[model samples]
Target: MCAFIKVSIATFAVCNRISKVLGFDDYKFIATPVVLLMLSFSIFVTQNTMESHFSISNIWQYYSFPFEAIIPFVVFIVAEIRRKRTKVL
Candidate 1:
């Protein structure tokens, strides 16, 4: 229930980008389609095959290592350089 609410509100915020005042009716309008789409996508991705699960995990592992581990160090180095130039610390 909590997860559904969080995801729905996030979907609503992303979809409701128009620069005008909208009320609860507008929210429901956007949220209803988002919820439907989420349900449909869940149905589509529900494969019980172990091969599919293994392939998905392999792809995530391949990408997650360099991006998750190395990118943080690069960001920290860049921030440190900027901080040194400004003498903030």
Candidate 2:
């Protein structure tokens, strides 16, 4: 569990850097789908693991992936929204 959490954090950090490098800040809506896909993958795998008697907190533990994905997604959203509002001004 600790390893998984660490890996997830690392993954999110890399995603943050990648989003900045790829200029995803200009595309807020695009990140939504990618985040959803990543979240779905994590949920699916967690569910499969649960069937094998592995302990995964259905509510909180399963939510970790979305929380992880949200960090970068939120950054992009904030940047995009700021850019748009500035343009309108």
Candidate 3:
């Protein structure tokens, strides 16, 4: 859990920086879909390589929701807070 939070924040930070440097103010929106697609593709590939079955169980599907949904939501919230703070200064 700790590792997941750390990696998620770090990934968001790096992608945020890159987007800024590339002049994209709405980078979070773009990054979210791309990251999700990559994650889904990787999971599919990994399951194919290691498991006899390619399908993910419903419980495991539920487990993935937080990582996919929560992390980006947190990142967006944090980014919004920071943006507001900087604008106020």
Candidate 4:
């Protein structure tokens, strides 16, 4: 699917960027295998991964709440404060 392809490309780009950040330029070739391995691992972790992924459970909801909600809100508030401070100057 298009979304999967986009995610895979993003993952590969992230891996390349990370390698550069870590001063591992010569190891760029390793990124492709690592990303593919991780993606495959995620897909085959359980028997019903794709099926169960759609049906959110309470535990996942609780675990993801701060990340999916709080962090973005905090970032937005911080950006707003900075914007207002800049406007006042």
- State each model's C-alpha RMSD to the native: 4.9, 13.6, 12.5, 3.6
Query: In model 3, what are the clashing residue pairs, if there are any?
Result: none
lDDT of 2 at 12: 70
**Where in model 1 is the C-alpha error above 4 Å?**
1-13, 16-28, 32-51
TM-score of each: 0.49, 0.30, 0.39, 0.60
**What stretches of model 4 exceed 4 Å from their correct place?**
24-28, 36-56
Alpha-carbon lDDT, every model: 0.73, 0.71, 0.77, 0.79
Error of 4 at 87 (Å): 2.0
What tens-digit string does per-residue lDDT give for candidate 1 at 21-67? 54443555666676688779766776566756886778768868899
lDDT of 2 at 86: 100
How do these models rank on lDDT, best leading?
4, 3, 1, 2
lDDT by residue for model 4 (1-89), tens: 99899987877777777778878966568677777887687677645755567545635788799999999999999999999999999
Q: Which wins on TM-score, candidate 2 or candidate 4?
A: 4
What local lDDT score does residue 77 receive in model 4, on the 0 to 100 scale? Answer: 100
**lDDT score for candidate 4 against the true structure:** 0.79
